[model samples]
Target: MCRSGTAMRLTALTLLALLLTACGAGGGQDAQKGGRKPVFPVQVLEVQGGTVEYAISSTGSVEAFEQVLVTARVRGVIEKVNFREGQEVNPGDILVEIEPQRYRNELEAAQARLDKADASLKDAQAGLKRREDANRQTPGIFSPDEVESWRNRVNSAKADVSQATADVKIAQLNLRDAFATAPMAGIIQSRSVQSGAYVQPGALIATLLRRDPLLLRFTVDEDEARSLKQGQQATFTVTDVDQPLKAVLTHIAASASSRSRMVEVIAEVAPEDRERVRPGTFARIRIVTGSRDNAPAIPQTAVRPTERGFVAFVVENGQARMRLLTLGLRTEDGRVEVREGVKPGEKLVVRGAEALKDGVAVKIDEPVQPQDK
Candidate 1:
């Protein structure tokens, strides 16, 4: 009975040993598999060489190329308002008419005075001629002083005639100015005086604005302003309009502003686009300063900012490889120029890149596709 009991105990111990060994093997296998590096699911894009435009973006307001304050040049009662508010006018188009009756009478009076003065001048010259003839025919009949006096009288009459002629011209000018005409081709923004409103010289009549080929006034940083040149191509969009408007950079401030430290710039819109945008409308301007040809560019989303300038992940041999990028100008779109550390046709990890490290295994979640320009 003792021997049988010992045999049963040894058999149970052997069975327990085998169970422990199997458990140890299974745990070791699990640990070994768990220690292997993980493969990350990712999406990537292939780099391409394309034309990239370097641009400076800014905000600005629309302005009229020419704005003028129409003022009355003569004192009179406004008789007629020929143009309504907001009416387009051409050069020499009559805008307002003042009562000309009083000015007409003044002109007539001036002309009569001139005529009288002319007759007096003629009479004075005739007398001087008669005196000189008498003096020449009979020596010592008229003294030198007397002849001189006649000559002086003729000079005085001539001066009076000249003054009268000048007065007549002044009166004519006043009469003509009584009818105010447009000095330029523009739109009347506002009319301050109505018919029968009395106005004096320099009185506000209306405001005129040249709308065609409007000016877009914007400001830029000092560096960008320095790079800008006359006739540079640009574009802008307003909140109200879907279509972008094109313009040409025309002027740059010689010095920067004190408050904003930015230089002001002016861009001229095309005539066809002028009516679509109004003065004082806010605009977002993008000035195309230059272009890059055959530049390898990547999506902005693929670039990750690092303690060092920037880094991007590119897939090589099914592994995430890190690259330090020397970035160049960023295009208006989100594409950034890769100046160094990348090449065309390289697959850049756009998705699942943030969690990747150098030499991490990568399982491409989506096939590489051509980047839409």
Candidate 2:
């Protein structure tokens, strides 16, 4: 009975095995028909070599090209202020007027003294001529000592006249100085003294700023500063301004700042853009440090930063391949220069790279052309 039971169990197991084999064969056939790996859709660009301009960004303030402090040249009561605050003035434009009565009176007094001295000089010359005539006509009639005395008197009168004439010139100059004039063309920044106020010589009257060509002052780190050169182009934008100001680097400090260890740089704003900006306005400046020509470049979206280095995806043989790159300059636009590990004319996956893995199959749309550098 035990032998018969064992034989039945083996027959049941054999039938179950046959049913499993048939199901496995059917599953294998289905997989063979419909098991193709997915092809990821992606956007790509043909990598091209072009010029890349590297920039260093820094913040700075706009300053006037030149600043002048207008001062009072003579002491008097301020009679009239000819200019309002922030008025545009030209060279020789009268800005302030001091009370001219005092200066006028002084000039008149000097003129009168000069006239008196002139008359005295004439009298002295006439006297000396008369004495000489008398001595020549009558020999020994006038003593030598007496002739010498006449000559000395004439010389004294001439000296007095000369002194009075110099005083008159000084008085004339003082009167002219009573009216303060602009020494240069600029915009008045402030008005320190008002009409009817007393002012002394050398007292601050107003501040003037030359705004036709503004100056932009900024600082760079030690490495960037060392590489800076005069005549490099820079562009800056200020708050609330739609347009940017173009400038050229004109000056670089010989030594770095003691406190910050950064070097100072100066740039002159383009003449056409100066009036649009004002001094002390904060600006963000991008200075062109260097440029690369015909360098392999890719769009910024294609590159991803990782712990080891930067990684990019390139399409090769209808599959995505990962590339490690040594990067150089990033241009003003969105292109990044690849220093190593990439070549021109290669297909770069600019978009749809987030989901891509190395060696994955990809279905690319129409390849994009690279933009002008």
Candidate 3:
């Protein structure tokens, strides 16, 4: 009886030992599975505030402020063209000269007539003086009717002299008109009439463009137009030009076009840069609507679209924290303005943001480098 009791006790102790070991193994497995750590490879950036300019880009053409179509003012055969094709000219520079022989002959005839009229006026004055003296010497002997006739003849001779003087002035003006001169300083873009081509009054001879202080015209959409104002500064780039040209906003249309729903804007280029640009060239305009000082911004690549809103991953205490951000304007490059949800001097995960989640542990294998301008 004593041996059997001992055996039963030993068996119970062995079973209890086995049960304790199984419980310990189950606890170990739970710990290994539940306490697993998340590992993330990320790139980080320091966020800071600075001046940020928001710009709108549009394509437009370069234009001239003053474009003139040169035309003949008088009808005649073109004798000589003083200006060559694509020549630059100043105001009052003679561009073309018509045949002046006809006008010269008319002027000579007018001068001869004027000379004859002057001689006739001298004779008429002498006659009037003689008639007045006769009237004074013999008031009753000289008939009043005869004196009146002499007065009328003197008046008629004076009228003839006045008419001839007017003719002479008209002839001189015609001779001056034979030479066509430029009305403004500009470059000759095209020439339509040759040296020997017969041209009438108002015939197109050439086209001139005022290139100095050139004008640039562009249209902006309704949303963009709302941000623009007069007297703003803008920069533009043209094809084949290495650097951008600067200009000032001169005008903003008060009303938008009904059909296109766009507003027209005009910018004036500086005179010094006019030689490098030409009219009708395509250009790209960047207009700055507003600017922010000391604002937090991040590379556009760092931002990712999420279900809630735009989000960016930030590395804090070696863990990834997803932040909801409010965005502002985008810069010319790939950077975007962060209005809220991020502070300056905080590191942002730029490269590995896509593969990250909230509370994930991150290991920054490489540092992020800024892009070149």
Query: Listing every candidate in turn, what is its Cα RMSD in Å to the true structure after a full C-alpha superposition?
Result: 3.9, 5.3, 6.4
TM-score against truth, every candidate: 0.84, 0.75, 0.79
- Which candidate do you rate higher for lDDT, 1 or 3? 1
Weakest lDDT window of 10 consecutive positions for candidate 3? 364-373
Estimate the TM-score for candidate 1: 0.84
Model 3 whole-model lDDT (C-alpha atoms): 0.87
- Model 1's lDDT to the true fold? 0.90
lDDT tens string, model 3, 1-373?
9999999999999999999999999999999988958787877778878999888999898998888998887788999888877799999998888878888999999999999988887887888788789778877566778778778877888898899999999989878878888889999988888988898989998899888779999999988988888788889999978999988889889999999998899999866677778899999999887789999979988889888999998888989999999999888778999999899999888886777889989998677766621
Number of the top lDDT candidate: 1
Q: What is the lDDT, from 0 to 100, of the residue 20 in candidate 2? A: 100
Runs of candidate 2 exceeding 4 Å displacement: 1-51, 221-232, 254-261, 289-320, 332-335, 344-373
Instruction: In angstroms, give how far residue 45 of model 1 lies from its true place.
Output: 2.7
Q: lDDT of each prediction vs. the true structure? A: 0.90, 0.89, 0.87
**Residue-level lDDT tens digits of model 2 in 1-373:** 9999999999999999999999999999999999998898888988888888778989999999889999998999999999987799999998888978899999999999989988988888887788789879988777888888878888988898899999999998888889899989999998899899999999999999988678999999888987789998899999978987899999999999999999999999998888789898999999877778889988877899878799999999999999999988876677788999789888889888998899999999877766621
Off by over 4 Å in 3: 1-42, 140-148, 220-232, 258-261, 288-290, 305-308, 352-357, 361-367
